[model samples]
Target chain A: MGVKSTASNNATIFCNSKRFFRKLKEQKYLYMMVIPGIIWMLIFNYIPMYGIIIAFKDYNIISSFFEAPWAGLKHFSDFFKDDWFPIIMKNTVGISLLKLVFGFPLPIIFALFLNEIRNSTFKRTVQTISYLPHFLSWVVLGGIMITWLSESGMINELLVNMGILDKPVAFLGEPKYFWWIATISDIWKGLGWNSIIYLAAISGVDVELYESAIVDGAGRFRRMWSITLPSISGTIAILFILAVSGLLNSNFDQILVLRNSLNASSSEVIDIFVYRMGIQSARFSYATAVGLFKSVIALMLLLLANWVTRKLTGKSLF
Target chain B: MRRKFLARRTKGEVVFDIVNTIIMIVICFMMLYPVWYTLVNSLNDGTDAMLGGIYWWPRVFSLDSYKAVFADSKIFRAFGVSFFRTIIGTVVHVFFTSMVAYGLSKRYLMGRKYFMAMGTVTLFFSGGLIPTFLLYRSLGLLDRFVVYIIPAMFNFYNLLIFQAFFREIPDALEESAKIDGANDFYIFFKIIIPLSKPVLATIALFTGVYHWNDYFAGVIFINNPDLQPIQTFLYRVIAETTSVHMLQNMPAGIRTTSVTSHTIRLATMIVTTAPVICVYPFLQKYFVKGMLLGSIKG
Candidate 1:
């Protein structure tokens, strides 16, 4: 019986191998098409993931990557003990939370209001104008922001003229206002573009629902509240989950362009900190450890948000 | 029926529409004013404009800043770099990604699930900054033009979009080509590509814009000043060179110059942004459609 079972198992494995080889040969051209992308993935994506082991090592420029001495948890501990830890965490979380609070709902509200516009030309014009900022790189927009918020610029000039301020103030130069500036500018840039998803979702709603609500004596606001809002709640929920997961991302491009020596205290986030440490200061291992830390926390946040949303709304990204 | 529905609009509805329209107008102004203000300043005489209070239009219209920006060899080189990168990057990215997507679209293709799983993992995590920097360094991509093209070759999200679109193409089309003795490459380059023009344009525009706007590559990978793109050049001009300290420390005599760096800065901003703004109106519908195709689940 043992001999017979062994022979059967060997025969099954041989058959599977033969079939796999035949399948591979048949799809050789398809494999040729796909292999380049797979190679790119291995080199650019997977290799870096493997290289993340340096986060545990005491890596330096002088030493080869593999030759670097292992110092388990040292870099991470050092990062935790670093004095900039609290400040960076605060700024990262603070700016992100501010953006989430102000930036998230404005788009939905904007879309809702834009939907109510009866004139197609007027609506199209507003959308076109609004989305213009989104296409501009943060560098360009940051440059514009700097110009407009300078003491001699438009915002200050307007305020001084309107008697809102006795003097022109450099808004970006003030550390206290960095969070607000970042949050507001982020919303400004994304408001129209972000609303596109919500608007698409709203458009998909059954028009009969709105007609029925109107027939039931529901007013415009009532119809909006009951029909429009509920119809697009899935999109809202998904976006909210994404926002929560991305709480650590402080819009690194915006921060890089906007941050200066003056607002460095308020502007420094994990991403910038990592860039500074790794590239500027050449503390590669420490920066890698910090980046890994952030990535793990971000992954955790995404999973947590996905799980919670699934529990609450029966919807999840995964 | 719609006219009847419109006629039934309540007093509250009328008020809402009025308020909403006003708010939207304000929003539009808010969106447009910064760019307009920059344009006015760029076209204005630099020294005179610095005296402030020039809001709506240029107080002294002058093209000196634009002339200066154009004459500068460095800015011209940067523009060339930007133009080439956008063109080449978009073409390569579209062709390569869509080709791969074509292969993956076929369920019968061997190891399709594994390839997908590999891509899906990258969407969630990465090797972070230092390792990527080191990897690029070792790969001899640093300070090279190909760095822009190679590392950015495949975006997994874009691949998924292409795959989705490719799957919708009728299988009979490919089968007929196969029976005609046309190889996969021939079919892909001829039939598949021509039929996929809309998605191609959508992806091309996205990739082109990305290549045009990316400044981080200049900041990190490329050290050669000549290789820096226009956006990075603008970043240096606007962020680093025009710091408050420099502006404050500038000798009073320099202000007398017809084109100070300030106006030049504004001019450069407008020049860099002009292409985007010009194409925006025409490409706006495609962008909207692309955004929907990307985000909306069937």
Candidate 2:
């Protein structure tokens, strides 16, 4: 009786597998369309993920990936003990936090103020001009900025002329100014473009909310504070969560272009450290370890941020 | 008449409007002035620009810097690389990402959840730069043009965007096509492709801008000067050169008589940024729409 039942179960399994294959064959085109993407992800993303094992191994150019001897936690420990580790972390967190604190809110304010503008032509023109900087590469902007912040450049000239400085000052040459420069420049590049999302949210707000508020004698400021703010709170929350997760990411391209020997103390963020160690110095294993550490921390931060936002505002990225 | 009456502003509101308008003007000036200053400097005689009081216009008007920039064969080659890469990369990315998005959008597709989970994992974590570089090296992608195209072909964010857009498309349209004996590929090519023009254009612009502006890939992957994109070329010219060193490495065949390194660098900056600035005005709405779509939970 047991043998007979097992045979029937095997027959049913075979029948189910045949039906699945038939369904798959019928929708073969869908499979064909998705296959390229799956293959790409495996080759580009998954392989790299697998290659991250080098962080645990004593990887070198001379040895094949599998042949590399295990180093366990040696590379990670070395990174923590590295002389530049503290400085790198400081700069990364400093610049990223500065941008978050100052750079994040300016866009929401910009969007709100932009929404207040009554004239369409003026509004469109302002928006067009504002977003122009975002499209330009940091290479171009950095080149322009290097000249503008030089001792003899426009910024120094303006400051000196306005009695803000006694003499020309080299803005980029000073390590003290690097964080501010990075943050401000990031804001300048992103302000209008960043505001686009907020503006979209504002446009979606019900017109009747404003009308009813006005009828209730609420001023524009009150309406904006109570109505528009709450309307787009979800967007703000999501973006803030994203910002929190990216706390370690200083703008690599911007920093790389702007950094010189004089500003190295303040400009050496984790991304730069990784680039220098891995690509420049060819300390691949150590760099991979450092990068892995950052990735793990970033993932944890993202999950934590998502959890907090969900708990506080009932909004989550997932 | 009632609407007009209701639109009347209070004294405080009037003051607020004035303040807001002034603020907007200042912001606009702040945004425009740097590029304007760069343009002025680029157009100025290089030696004269060193005197450093030229704020609004080129005091000694000359096109020598631009002339010098245009004269370089390397710059032209780099520009060609940038152009072709942006076009080809955008095309391949839009096609591949949208194809996958459409397939994934089908709720009944086999192993759909697993496929989505695979794509979703990429969003939060990546195998850091060194591993990626190593993987690319092993794949023989380093220093090759296709390195730009293949690795960038499937962005998960873009796939999500396309999936959201594709799902909004009426099932009836696709069902009708299927009833006519059309397969998924044929319907996607014939019907869906035509319908998805806005999203396609939006994604295309985004991917194009990214490719054009990216100097990191060129800096890390491609060592060959001939393969470097224009932005990378500009980065090299700007980052490596001081005024003193510029004289040594000034483009071999050009007369640097009226052009200094600073002015030439500004010219290079202008040239690199010109394509984006020129196209931005017309494409502004689409970019805003793209941002909005991206912000949505896809």
Candidate 3:
């Protein structure tokens, strides 16, 4: 019996190997098509992984990577001990939370409101105009915002004219107002564009559900509340999961352009911090450690969010 | 009673329509006001713009800003660089992304699951900016146009959308092509390519917009001013508002002499954004459809 079983297992292994080789030969062209992509990824994505070792070493441009002496945990400790660490953390988390609270819901609300409009023309116009800002680079938009918010700019002039204030408020120059302004500007830029997904999801909701509700004496509001919202609940959940995953991402480009020395206290996020320290200061190792730290945290949060969604809602990002 | 109910319903509908129109118009103004402000301000006389006199209309309309922008040889060169880079970068990005996406779309493809897992891992985790910079440097790609194209070639999300679209194509098409002894490449180009025009067009527009608007990569990778794209050039104009040297060699008495320092900033912005805005309307239908299709699902 043992000899027979051994022979059967060996035969199975041989068969699998033969099938694999045959499959490889048959799909050789497909494999060839994937070569450039794989090579690009390996060169640009994978090779950079070796540089992560610099986080542990006292890396310097003059010394070879291998010759750089290891200083395990020193960079990490230095980052934690830095005077600006808390400020940066506070700004990053503060801005992220504000975006989550304000920017996330803006699109959802806009979509819901837009869904109620019966006029297709108006809907498309609103969508087009709203989405225009998203296409404009932050560099340009930043200039626009500065012009509008400057002491002599439109907003201040309007406010003063309305007798809302005796003097013009320096909106961008003040630290206290910077975060709020950033959040509002972000919402303004993305509200329409971000809502496109939700609108699509709303459109995907079965028309029959609305018809049945109407037959049951449901008003427009009731039908929307019961039918439209529930139909796109899955999409909302998925987007929420995605948003939670990137709780650390505060949009570096937006902040970088919007930032000034006066508002740096409120505007600096992890990405901007890493840019300033790593790229500007040339503390490559320390910056990598901080960035790696953020990426790891974000990944862990993503997995946790996915796990929780799977457990509670029976849906996962995967 | 029936007449009364019909009248009430019609009245409610009328009210809703009016309210909706008003709200939409207000939102449109809010959306467009900033852009309009920039445009009008750019065209206004420099001193008038500085005094915040121009709002809904240009106080003293002038083509000086436009002339100022075109007068500079650097702006023209940068525009050419941007156009070339966008064309090459977008084409390469779409081709590689679609090819890989097509390969991965097949269920029977070996190592599909592993490849997918690897792709997903990249979506959430990267080796950080420092490492990526070092990697690019080591490859002798830094400061090259290839640096702009290679790193961002395969956006995994876009690839997934293409893969999904390819998977939806009827299998019988490939089966019949196979029976005719058509090779995979032949089938991909001859059959699949023709069928996938919507997605191809969508990806092209999307990639084009991304590459055109990108200045971050240019700032980090390209040290030479000559190689800088339009966005980077505009960024410099904004960041260093006082530097007339950047705009030197313009037609005499064009933008350099007339536009206020602040209006110059706005003018540069308007110049950079106008091309994108012009291209948008033509592509809006496909662009929105593509975004919806790509984003609505996983």
Candidate 4:
């Protein structure tokens, strides 16, 4: 009985291996097509995942990632105890929430405003021009911003000429106004381009709803409130979830470009802090710790957003 | 078209329409004036621009700023670097991303689910900046040109886009090819790729734009000035407006006679921005298509 069972098990294993090999052979070309990308992802995407271990290690540039001495929770504890932690946290959350509140709604409002335009030519022109800034790099936009915000720039010129201001203000140099500057610049750059989805969402609304509303003597405002906003609410909800989940991001490019020593108090966020600590100061372990903290929080937010979105709208990103 | 249904207007509606049009026109002017501000200053006489009356156009129209940018050998090199990276990076990125997407789209293939998950996992998580920098350092990829191409080859979003596109290509086509004794490689290269042009174009336009605009890679990966893209060079020129670096590594003697630092700054912005802007009209449709497609579930 033992001999028979052993033979049967061996036969089963042999059959499975044969089938697996046949399957591989059948899809060999498809495998070939994707293997390079897989390998690339493994190296660029997955391998660094292993490097996340350095968050707990006293990692040195000279020392290998795994070879570094394990200093359990030292880096994280140090981050918690550091005075800059709260400041960075405050700045990151502050800027993110501000952007979420201000930046998120601007595009929606812009889309609604745009939707009201009866003239296609005018609407198209506004959209095409607005998206131009979105394509421009932070470096260029920063230069543009600096030029505009400069004492001699057009904005100051306009303000001073209009008697709205007593004197030219160095908007970029002040920490107190950095949030507003960042928020406004973000809206300026993205308002049109970000509105594209909402516009598309608005377009997908049933034409009959509007036509019927007009038949019932619904005014433009009333029809908009009844028809357009509700139809596009899904897109808005999805984008809102995405925006909220990205609350920790804090517009790294915009901040980095606009940041200066004077405004560091308001401008320094989690990403900038990580870049400074990790690259500039060579505090790899500490930076990794902070970065890990950010990623963990980001992950939690994403999951929470996805869960909430699924529960409410029956749609999710996962 | 929307106006035909309700041409009759109340005072409130008329007022709202007027306000909306005014707001749009004002916003349009605001958006445009900054680029114009930089432009007029770029073309103005360096000394004249310093006096700050050059608003509508150049006070004494001169080619000084453009000439100065052209004279800077580093700008030339940076442009060449940026141009070459955009071309090669875009091609390699589109090909590999599409190829992977094609493979992952084959749900019946063995282990395809795991492959797709491998991609989706990377979409949500990353190793952050330091570890990536350290890993690149260890791999001797820091400052290398291949660093641009390899790390960016497989974008998960592009992958899903390609997968979604490939799924729409009927299975009957592939089944017929298989019956003809043509393998998946032959089918992909000859049949699938030929039919995949629209999606390919959309991906190419976006990833190309990304490559052209990227300087964060240079900021983190490469410290060599020679290896820096035009964007990074402009970034430095903008950030360090007062430094000697603004003078294009030229001899100090030429500095006093050259364009003002501000003029040079505008010129740099123009030179960096114009390439992308030039292609915008041609590729704008593809991006709109691509972006909307992204919002839809794959």
Candidate 5:
């Protein structure tokens, strides 16, 4: 009886292997199509994962990756104890929060206002004009901003001519004002582009609800407050959750382009700091440690936000 | 009496329309003022531009900036490199993205779930820049044009968009093609490609924009000045111009003002950004449709 049972088990295993190979053959074309994508991910995404070890090593180019001496948590400790840590963290969090407060709501408000326009031509024109800024690179936008906000630039000239101040305000140079200027400019660039999604969601709202609201003698404002907002609440909630996930990311490109020595104190975020330290200074280990810290926190925030959203609204990102 | 009531209501609506028009015009000006300022100042004489002379219009208008930019051989070379890179990179990106998206859209594909999980993992958690750079170095892609294209080939968001579009394609079509003895390649090229033009166009536009605008990858990977793309060259121009401004403030012998730097920088910006901006309106219809379709699946 024992011999028979052992033989049967072997036969079953053989059958399973055969079935797997047959299925593989049936789906060969599908596999072929996915080859380039898989190869790309393996080369670009997965291969880079191996370099995370440099975060724990005293990375040196001459010594090669495998020979680099291990530093354990020394890099992390150095970053934590660094003089600029508190200031960098404060600036990053503060600027991101300011963006969250102003930039996040502006698009929603714009979408709401746009949804009121009955004429499609006017709406389309507004959208096209508004979204143009988003496509412009930070390099281009930065040059334009610098030109417009310089001492003798348009804004300062208008202010001086109107007698708003005795002299041109140093908008970009003053550290205290840099954060606000950065946040506002960021909003201006993204406001229209960001509203595209919200507008799409708003357009998907059932027209029957609006028609019924009108029959009930509801005013435009009343209908918007009642039917429109609630209908798109899911979209808002999802976007809000997604936005919260990236609370740590104060756009590096914009900050990098706009930063000068005079305003570096207020403008420098973790990304810029990482680029400066890692790439510029060649302190790979310390930069990696900082980046790792940010990534871990970001991942935690995303998971927590997703969990909370799922629990409250039964909607999760995954 | 009915005509009079209609006329009164029309009058009221006209008044409301005028108010709306004024508000919209103000918004439009606010949107366009910076661009206008940059364009006007770029064409004006550099000194006049610096002295707050160009407001809504150019003062002492000249094509000297354009002349200066054209005179720089580096600009032309950079533009050529950029153009070539954009075409190749965009094509490779679109092809791979569409293929993987189509493959993943099929429910019967083996390990589809695992592959999808891997792709999504990349969206949130990257190994950061050091790891990525080290990987590129190890692969001998450092300072190579492939560095730009390879690293950017698999955009998860674009893949998702394509996947959503592919999923919408009727399964009957594929089945019928198979029954007619057409292979997967033939089906994909003949039927799927024809049906997928809208999404393909959208992805192409997006990928093209990314290639045109990106300077960071070139800055990080390409150390050779000869290989530098237009965006990077434009950045160098701006940085050099800023440094020149600083030099101008220095004491006696150190100060050497380059009068044309400002104009040159502005002209470069126009040239670099113009192509992308010009193509945008042509693609606007696809942009909205693509965005809407992508969002629905997400």
Candidate 6:
């Protein structure tokens, strides 16, 4: 009786396997289409994920990355214990917060005012000019900025001649001004491009709202504040949550371009710290530990922000 | 009634419009002047540029900087590397990403949920820099041209963009193709792809621009100067020349050149930036449409 039941079970398993193959064969082309991408993802993305174990290991060039001896949180504890930890953490959190305060609102304000423009040509020109910088790599912009902010460059010349300064000051050379420059430049590069979403959101608001506001003798500013702002608040909430979640990134490209030894005190942030420690100096384990710490924090922040956003605004990234 | 309303403007409203227009014009000037300043400086004689009076227009109107930038053998090779990766990277990105999106867009495709979850999980979490770098090193990708194109072939965001686009094709379109005995592959190639030109162009533009602009990958993966892209090469030049003493210490080619480091910097900037800015207007409409669709749909 036991043998007979086992045979029937084997038969049923075989039948299920055949049906699975037949269904797969029916959409064989679709399967073929997706196979390469999945394979690529598996290699380039997922495989690297397993490499995260290096953070807990004493990894080096001689030893295989996976086979390296486990250090078990030694790297993580070492990073937190390091003297430069406070400086980098402060710089990262400070710059990100400043950017959140200054950079976040410029685009929204620009979009709001831009919507008031009656002339389509003027609006289009402003938009085109504004977004042009967004396309130019920071390598170009940073080079331009170096020249512009030079002691003898246009900015210094204008300030000295205007009598706003006794002499040309090296803006990039000073630590006090570095944060503002980073934040302002971030806004400058992204303001117009970022406004595209808000502008899109505003466009979807009912046209009759505007017409009725006109009937009610409401001014443009009044209509904007009462109707437009409220309409796009959902988008603002979503983006704000995403931005808060990304506060750890601090835009390595921008810092790498703009930073020098003179301003490294203020400019050195988490991502730059990782690059210097990991790629440049080849402190692989410590860098991975720092990176893993940052990733975990970022994930927590995202979840927290999403929760807060839903609680406060009835909208969330999720 | 229309004529009367057009003729009437409250004094305050008129004043507000005038103020708004003036502010807009000033903003426009502020936005344009930085790029304009760079062009003026780029065109001026390098030595004259150092004297600091040049503004609004080139003072000496010399093309020596441009000539010098072109004369550099490294710049030529860098440009070649940049162009090669951009074209190849963008094509592979659009092609495979589209295929994957097409598969996902089909409602009846098996294991779609698992496939989607696999891709989506990556958006939030990743093995950090060390792991990714080590993986590349282990795979023998470092210092090779394949480093730029391979790792970036399947952008998760672009996958969503492609999926959103593919999902929009009316069901009837695919149904008719199926009824005519065309398989999924045939319909995707002959029908969906031709109709997806706008989206494909948009994704291509994004991927192409990314390849053009990215120096971070080159910084991490490629150590050889010959394999470096234009941006990375320019970054090296900028980093080296920031200290005057360093430039003086450099091999004679840069120090002996007639062009100032400032002018050389400007020329390099223009060389790297011009192509993207020039091609921008043609891609602008599609870019906006793509951004809107991706944002709204995602």
lDDT, candidate 2, at B202: 92
Per-candidate DockQ versus the true complex? 0.76, 0.76, 0.56, 0.65, 0.52, 0.69
Residue A127 miss distance in model 5 (angstroms):
1.1
lDDT of 1: 0.88
Candidate 3's DockQ: 0.56
Q: Candidate 2: which stretches are off by over 4 Å? A: A1-11, B5-7, B242-247, B253-255
Write the residue-wise lDDT of candidate 1 on B142-230 in tens digits: 99999999898888888888887887789899899999988778888888899988788889989998999999998999999999999
lDDT of 3 by residue, A109-159 (tens): 778878877667878878888788888888888778777787888998889
TM-score-superior candidate, 5 or 6: 6
Question: DockQ of candidate 1?
Answer: 0.76
Model 4 interface RMSD, one decimal? 1.6
* Tens-digit lDDT track of model 2 for A1-318: 585457557677677788688879988999999988899898888888888999999999878678999999999989999999999999999999999999999999999999988888999899988998899899988888888888888899889999999999778879999899999899999999899888889999998888878879898789889999999999999998999999987788999888887888999999999999999999999999999999899888989999999999999888
Query: TM-score for every candidate vs. truth?
Result: 0.96, 0.96, 0.92, 0.94, 0.92, 0.95
The candidates score, on chain A by TM-score, as follows 0.94, 0.94, 0.90, 0.92, 0.92, 0.94
Interface RMSD (Å), every candidate: 1.1, 1.3, 2.3, 1.6, 2.0, 1.3
Off by over 4 Å in 5: A1-11, A63-66, A310-314, B1-21, B239-259
Predicted candidate 2 versus true structure: per-residue lDDT over B1-298, tens digit per residue: 3375347778888898899999999999999999999999899998899889999989999999998898888988999999999999999999999999898889988999999999888988899899999988988999999989999989999989888888889999999989999999999999999999989989999999999999999999999999999999988877666333334555655655688877878888898899988998998877777777887853
Model 5 misses residue A205 by how many Å?
A: 1.3
Candidate 6 runs further than 4 Å off: A1-15, B1-8, B244-258
**For residues A1-318, what per-residue lDDT tens digits would candidate 1 score against the true structure?**
585457557677677788678768878888899999999999999988988999999998878789999999999999999999999999999999999999999999999989989999999999999998888999999998898788878889889989999998888889999999999999999999999999889889998998888889998788778999989988988898889989998788899989998888999999999999999999999999999999999999999998999999988787
Per-residue CA lDDT of model 6 for A1-318, tens digit only, reads: 585457557677677778678779988999999888888888878987888888999999879876899999999999999988999999999999999998898899989988877788998888887788889887777777777776777889999999999999878778788888889888888988899899899999997787777778888789889999999999999899989999998988888888888888898898999999999999999999999999999999999999999999999989
Model 1: pairs clashing at backbone N, Cα or C within 3 Å = none
lDDT tens per residue, model 5, B136-191: 78779888878778777778879999988888899899999999998787888899
lDDT of 6 by residue, B1-298 (tens): 4344336667877887788888778877877788888888889888888888788899889888888788878888899999999999999889889988898888778898888899998888998788899888989999999999889889777888888888888999999989999999899999999999999999999889899999888778899989999999888777545645224422246533347877877887887888998999778888888888888755
Candidate 3 lDDT over B4-116, as tens digits, reads: 43455656667876786787788788888899988998888876666775778998887777776776788788888889888999998888899988887877778888877
